[model samples]
Target: MFFNRQEIKFMFDENKRLNSKVKEFAKKNFHPKNFLFFSDSGSGKTTIAEKLAEELAKRREICYKSNDSKFIDYTNQEVLVKQELIHNTWLLKELLNLCEKDICPMNCKGKTKIDVMTKYNIITAQDPFDDIFNFKKRIFDENPAYSKDKRIGLHRRFSKSKDYTHGYMFKVTNRYQSGKVDFQITCLKESDDSAGDINDFVNGRFDIKFAEETTLEEAKKRVYDDDFENLYKHKGDVFLKREVDMDHVLGGVICDVDTENHTFSVYNKYFDSEIPSTMIPPKDLNRLNERLRNKIINQFGPDHEITGTNKRT
Candidate 1:
């Protein structure tokens, strides 16, 4: 029999309660662990993630960004989407502080760039800066200024110390993981500020980490193994271990997607043999392990049972 008015109201209320419960469960318990969304370039992963993030944000869960280095100093304030989003900056305000002294061209004129070159121990400058700065050299090839000791007595000084310039300080990071990522985040470092070191990145201190477009083996070696785990134990960084027991089944974006053609591969880690070898996941995710799945088919016919995302339906 059909329900009456009161029963219908009660049913509606119960349905609402169940829907709310499902949302809560998904928000709390549902984690996409080593899960890959097989989609094309315009398949709308970010669009879906955006809607999901907005819902999660309203729940007040701690979802900060891990990409920006500029926000490290201002960690206390701001409801940051990405914590390190702005931390690795060479703050222009620092130059304002430097300008409190006498007129300095490097600080007063244009954009000042700084870098920590691993090959070069000493930091150099484009515009001549500092108080004790002097003309180093301006030796011409044909008409060489060999006797170039003007102050000492023989020749004139070639370059003058630039004393009136301005600049806005800025800091940068390694290339981002993807075009869709909004988080400009980075992590805390134990060493001095160094720009764009792969070691610094793989160390994984920042909120958002990026796996650059590189070799599959290289990505696997950096994210997995003893050294990475050590950083986990010491730095308290997030560790999402991807355990696999398959060959050529590395986990990442299923590169070169032609789903209609039924060909794809992940760039994470896979096995060459029985051992965990470094390689991409098999191009054909549809390929069934006849030996392994045979147990199921023995009980029931091959076409009767349903398989999960682990293998193709």
Candidate 2:
């Protein structure tokens, strides 16, 4: 194998146990709620979540929320709700809980008049990095041209002898007599304060900050080697039969509704392809309304495909 067999085996075994626990939790007769399963990169969190989504689908209409449309391509068992849906669902849950206690002003009973322009501060924990990484991953995976541009840019920026550039430390990992393109890695966050952005965010304010480092070679392999099949080994094949143009739907841009034509237009910077109103699928028209809602920075899933097209992460 060209990879670490031992690490892969460990991940597979741990994911099996994690999937069982997730399935059990999903099977319980609990309130309709949102569950977030998170882990470090290449740790099989998505692998386990995909399996759990299948097991949960047996009970209720499970929705797989992510920015990555590829996940939707691999599974028809769950509804694909983008990041907006996930946030709306979470907010709805909070409002419902407050309503049950008769403390919310926006309760269905309408005991009091709800006022607009109220500057209410809603503070929620946000995972901004994961979303960003995933969105970049999707683009790097799907658009070879964009990926090549990035790779070339990095090489140019770090052309000096073995050293660190910005936060990344580039080093030649192996050399061969055949004069093959020498394999190298760009490692980052070597120490607790290596990442200045992260350091600035949590420095002085927080005493503890956790970090993990992975080689560029391993990261790139994980991206290219990842397949939807490993996630659904026992579930069989899944085909997307919907007429929805996912490329437009999940391509990351908010659509503009043309009321006169009764259609929507989506733009893709990657292709410079603007989906004309006529090409828009009726099922995707709903996303036009979603754009009206205030955009939240800290959405549920790590910024997936949706963030790739959105105005901002």
Candidate 3:
């Protein structure tokens, strides 16, 4: 099936709305308690972080670094905080240990932070690309709900004879198509240098991250996606959702909140598919997906539908 513009536009619009809500929160809790980069489904938290950094750019600059810094110790990257963190210094050095400058083709290989940022135009003060591709599989599988934009998808990089993006390369893995949409789903690892760099600079920085055709989940991850889902009350609505019918089961949803204008939204699948019923203690999604488990029946099993229905993966 071709890409649906309405879904993409709708998601983008939700991003704008979510951005406003985040700004409000920033205004309320603008202090340096800590830099919070989070979101549920359509609440572009990372997008906001990049934008905030971009706005901060008016005053300062931004840097991006590979997430490996979190795992590795003794990272050469300046943003690599010396204090004990998620990843140790040895791990950091071990990771970049061999990154050995992109120039040394003989020793160095794979995409660099600069490589990915340049492609995406994210001028963070630190580099965060090297490890981005590392967790591609998990990022694509669990986080972000995406809808490919065909027009832009048709738009190709200057080098490619035909567009060479889609899930295969970026790891978005659109189950709908044999080849997935690259820009459709993105990776959002919380322990990223991008945000850390912003925190490093108390002054902050201005940054614009156009995660075009990607979902907030893929762009950010469970850490922020979880925050985004619960960040709805302030939006002046009750139920807010972003409907995407690209990959995995159904689309995404932003449920439970009596906000103002825009409240709730669900994936095209929920809209397209008829609601299924559940008896007593129904099945969890894990069991349902297991074809062997005749014990599990419908897709919206008890766990996924009633309890675990906040968002779709």
- Compared with the true structure, all predictions reach lDDT values of 0.25, 0.26, 0.26
Runs of candidate 3 with Cα error greater than 4 angstroms are 1-33, 70-313
lDDT of each residue in 71-106, candidate 1, tens digit only: 222211111122111212223233222222121122
Stretches of candidate 2 off by over 4 Å are: 1-30, 59-61, 66-313
TM-score of each: 0.16, 0.17, 0.17
lDDT digits (tens) for residues 1-313 of candidate 3: 5659998899899999988776421111110112222122233323434544343233233444334433222212211111111222223233231221211111113433432111111211122233222223234533332222311221121011121111111212223222111122122332111112211122122121222243444434312234366322222322112221111121222223122221222222213343322211221333222331232234444343354333322
Worst 10 residues of 1 by lDDT: 115-124
Q: For candidate 2, lDDT tens digit of each residue in 127-218?
A: 22223222243445333122333333322221221221122111211121111111112222222222212111111111110112333332
Which regions of candidate 1 fall more than 4 Å away from where they truly are? 1-193, 207-313
* Model 1 whole-model lDDT (C-alpha atoms): 0.25
